[model samples]
Target: MGLWLSCVALSSADVRISVTNGAAACPCLGPAKHTPYTTMRRMTTRSTSGRPRIAVVGTGGTIAGAGNAADGAPSAAYTSAVTGADALIAGVPALARLADVQAEQLLQIDSADFTDAQLLLLARRVVALCVRDDVDGVVITHGTDTMEESAYFLHLTAHSAKPIVLTGAMRPGTALAADGPANLLHAVAVAAHPSSVGRGALVVMNEEVHSARDVAKVHAMRLDAFASPHGPLGLVVEGVPRWYRAVTRPHTTTSEFDIAAIDALPLVGVVTSHGNMRREIYDAWVAAGARAIVHAGFGGGTVPEYLKPVLAELCAAGVPIVRCSRVGAGPVIRNASFDDDAAGSVAADDQNPPRARLLAALALTRSQGVGEMQRIFNRY
Candidate 1:
């Protein structure tokens, strides 16, 4: 009996050792990476070691880029970003003092590859973290590529009291005097500061804070790559926030659409009208699977007459359509230019094509039927 007991104890010890080694090898079992950005939550550490435990969720973008070749170009940058959250934070020690930081990798792909479903997933995860008590706020280190889309999605959907901020470096970390550390350190400072709350999902860059909805990539290859055509919400100077105009929309922990009872996303399509436009492009997409089509019409939502017959057919077939202007700014009028608002067609006045597309898709996804879809767009 004593020999049998010793064998059992030995077996247990060996099992534990194996488990420990396995845990150490895999990332999920170790010190949580990218906590603030992911859907999953982690244990509160006693470390008190870093900033205030602000989770840095890593969604792969240029932010996670590493030079493909060694000694290739110090100006051409590279990082062993096997992980984005911890790796970025590790590079910026200034983050260590601004907030208790935990890294989490949500989506580690280039932001350009992101789709509607991915945006939904990221929004869901950010909302999940905001509802938790242990987490103070969240910061997303995203690729500047599609950062605006994700930011706007979060701004429109997620409900949160904590500050949700997205930041990235224009130049790679391998570049001389890389800009990432400074941007990240400032992002952490803004994420931890109290004034950042109540504002919608914000993009912090070049020490400037811009609303996700109003901000866009104005410069092609500059450190100040993003610009809000209307202007910035505020500025972050040496780790402190100062706001000018008060954000008035129902956002941050107070949005019905943020946590509304909606699950499956509606089938939406984007159809751009070009010179000598043919109907086949629109017809093929409708035949494929598009429930609603956002017609990227010319100025003021006007479409070529050649395609009008097809659009009329589309309306007859019961596919809901919204006329969104391809123009970067301005509202899409309901019937002012299309000459068909009197019918089933709708307009997305003043909203750019992308934002209009998102609104149209989301609106259709919510309503029970086509009539409801039109009503959703009109109501909004």
Candidate 2:
């Protein structure tokens, strides 16, 4: 059961590869076109017997970054997402031994630069790959800056039981002890593992596997920056993944979100409520075409007493308001002492401000009612 690559040139610049039973088609991994079938040029490699077929889609981040000559050893000041998917795959030779690996370069940019349209496109690509009979799992190489948000977006919309693992490095690949190769290897391992199926989208880094909904990048430069406050679902040690618990949240195939039919997401914004927070910030977002807003409030989603009236007024004006916490870990309770449910506001259980914004945007695409928005938050 060895992997084999069969290439067919659709055009002079485009090549389509069919990797026997090991890995499926290797088309262009560049920016997605109007249709999902457009092909691009990339190399493909085969694998050993009885290996799972894994596809690695590269959307650059620190894992693909490169340092300048002025930077010291293990360079910290490198440009992100400059490296290609081919180089990343070649850097981790061990990946070839585990599964039939296929590589594609989708985008080359910092994760922080990820736009809503790109997120939607990525979700569409992941869903397309998962539905294919040959692709057993999908591994996304992303920047650590906004990996959690992207992972969560895919988690809610992917609609697949096949493993979708996201991984990235805090350090550049050119660094003395680059973490990219190892993280990519672990991601592939998790993607190929049978246990990873039906686990929804996962973030694999520093040997830890976290559910997308719970994982966050808490540290700026540390290699172990990503963690789940509720603890990780499992870990990978020496290329073997061990489970500690199963994710109980409704996600993936169980989620009501469907990205396939959505071409564009509704406008949503996030405003942080702080000490002496001005009401103008909220006004600006609404003026800027925000259909919904996630107020990243103080502890447990509390807003200043002065801002309450304005929030209620916005709700009356038909913009849905979602309450979320800036403090990072606690659940924002609906109709809690400070939360006014009657004013067309909803609470985001444990989702942070960015994630809450995504949910709000997605929810708005389906319904505008506060109760329905709240139900969407509670279910997802």
Could you say which candidate leads in lDDT?
Answer: 2
Q: TM-score for each prediction?
A: 0.78, 0.86
Residues 72-189 of candidate 1 have per-residue lDDT tens digits of: 6754455423446788889876565466788889887877788887888888888888777667678998888778878877877887757899998776776665677788877877
lDDT of 2 by residue, 1-380 (tens): 43333334455445443434455433432232322332233222223345678989999999999896455644777889999998999988778767888888888889999999789889988988888777878999999988999999999999988889999999898787889998999998888765577888999999999999899999998888988888998888556566787788889999888898778888898998767788898899989999988999899999888988999999999988899999889899988846566777999999998899888988988988888998888887
Global lDDT for candidate 2? Answer: 0.82
- As a whole number from 0 to 100, the lDDT of residue 244 in candidate 2 is 81
Q: How many backbone clashes does candidate 1 have?
A: 21
Lowest-lDDT window of 10 residues in candidate 2?
A: 37-46
Stretches of candidate 1 off by over 4 Å are 1-51, 68-83, 368-380
For candidate 1, report its TM-score.
0.78
